[model samples]
Target: MKKGIVQVLCGEGRGKSACALGLAVKAAGSNKNIVVIQFLKGKNEETEIGRRLEPEIKVFSFEKSERPYCELSDEEKQEEAVNMRNGVNFAKKVLSTRDCDVLILDEILGLLDYGIIEPSDIQKLMEARDEDVDIIMTGIVFPEELNGCVDKISRIDTVDIKGV
Candidate 1:
């Protein structure tokens, strides 16, 4: 049997989520089911397009505030912690259930940055996935702790900004 592929798109640049979404689209093109769970960053221009993907690509977010998590007050951050955990649990569910062939945990590595979850949690989730599925995670930070667990890591480094 083919083994599952665990990939991470991480760095201090833009387009990590965009690359994950591209992977989802490629999988869906092959009639594969996809589930995307977003964290930290709240909404963007692409959210509506993702929603339109529908049953083929189910997108979910557990963030309560409309604003990005980074912009929220401490009080709001405390409140959002629960929701983010729920998102993590749901990711585990998706893996255990084999609900989708492609699982995109957008900005999930940021969970580690905020002390929301541990590397062991991610290790466990990776272990629980079906051998045939593919998992893709994106974040601004590359998780050194997961270097051994992840099959591949692509660094997105920004060279320059288009505008000042």
Candidate 2:
């Protein structure tokens, strides 16, 4: 059996999500099973890439509303916390199933940013994943605790473009 390694794409660039999506497409094209769990995106606001890969790729979201975290009220934040917890549980289930060849945790670092989930929680998930399931995490800030846990880490720096 082949072993699947963990890959992290993090930093302040615009292509983090795009990179993950591209990987998903490529994996699907190769007949590999892929699952994507988005931590901060809402159902209505999910990117078209997810929609386009439907059936071939499974996409799940934890967001309860379209409002950004900065704009959410205390009550909304509380509700979001529940949703985030659910997302964590869902991820655990998926990882344990070993049904997917690739598992993409999209913007999962945002949960750490909001203090909704701890680094230890992520560490536990990483430890529990199937040996053959490739885990890809994309976020702006990578947790220091996960420094040596992943096999590959790619930092994306934004390059300013004058005009499109």
Candidate 3:
């Protein structure tokens, strides 16, 4: 059987994006095409990590601003939401092409929390996914109904962060 999509919803501590990046690196080592779209976090080290790969993984970020040091204003929040929606749409287009072997949708849960991407839209995308591509989606507060369709579901619990 073909390896299936891996949905990792890590709400707690660390290693969410790290895990995804690790998978991407492994896939790239085997010469698989990889695409990563980070909804919340972007342009950090992980984004850079993919760049050094021989084939150079394609990395896209819909987040326009650097990580906020303080709480965001309503306008900034709206802007971020717009970026997230664009990211989702871009992912949809990429998926529609069905070209790559692995596609990563990072921090999509946060987008949903901020009321950016809707679960229903994601449901539609999953319904339409190409069986050949392996997908990894990281998010929080997973919708109650995504029970059977997802091949793997992992919920990372919260852990306290130290000395931020």
Candidate 4:
């Protein structure tokens, strides 16, 4: 069977990365090469999962701050942009090899949301890849331009418990 295009998991609720990681696991089990680029900090669960995963999984982080776990400095922001570009570049290289069946740009939308990376660059990255390689994009926010490029989009809305 041929692979699917891009699937964007976005919104305010949690589990975006979790859902993406799950898909990666399934793909890896099927002997499909997979790469996951995480932008957010402290994805210990994912790291642990990747370690236990057989056939090995390509996962890496480009986090700015180890403390506060929420804020990012200007330098961190710059580093993130570089790392984001590098990840996409690496994916492009991998796509040329025709080895990988899936590539997950985890938290990519968040990078775009924070203006760490350009939307045009992302569009180009999608265009440069093989049509059969499946992509699972996870982030809290989705830009309008990106929304148009994606094949399917699923949003997770949040529920407020206490009304202050």
Clashes of each: 0, 0, 1, 0
Model 3 has a clash total of 1
Tens digits of per-residue lDDT for model 2, 36-150: 9887765554544586778899888877777666578899888988897898888888888776899999888888898999998888889889888899999899987788779
RMSD of 3: 3.1
RMSD of each predicted structure: 1.7, 1.8, 3.1, 2.9
Could you give the candidate ranking by TM-score, starting with the highest?
Answer: 1, 2, 3, 4
**Model 3: worst 10 consecutive residues (lDDT sum):** 63-72
Question: Model 1's lDDT to the true fold?
Answer: 0.88
Task: Name the top TM-score candidate.
Answer: 1
Screening candidate 2 with a backbone cut-off below 3 angstroms (N, C-alpha, C), the clashing residue pairs are none
Q: Which ranges of candidate 4 are over 4 A from the true structure?
A: 1-3, 42-45, 62-70, 160-164
* C-alpha lDDT of residue 87 in model 3: 82
Please write out the lDDT profile of model 4 over residues 1-164, one tens digit for every residue.
68568999999998887888888888878888887767655445665566565455688664434532245576765665676667667766766776578888887777676676788867877887788888788888888867777898999877878972
User: Which digits, one per residue and each the tens of the lDDT, describe model 1 over residues 58-159?
Assistant: 999888677888898999988887899899999999999989998999988998999988889889988889989899999888668788878899999888
TM-score between candidate 1 and the true structure = 0.93
Per-residue lDDT tens digits of candidate 3, residues 1-164? Answer: 57557565566656777788788888888888888888776445655665675364788887767764125678887877787788888888888887578888877777767667677877876766788788888866666676565777777765556954
lDDT, model 2, position 125: 86
**Model 2 off-target regions past 4 Å?**
47-49, 161-164
* TM-score against truth, every candidate: 0.93, 0.91, 0.84, 0.81
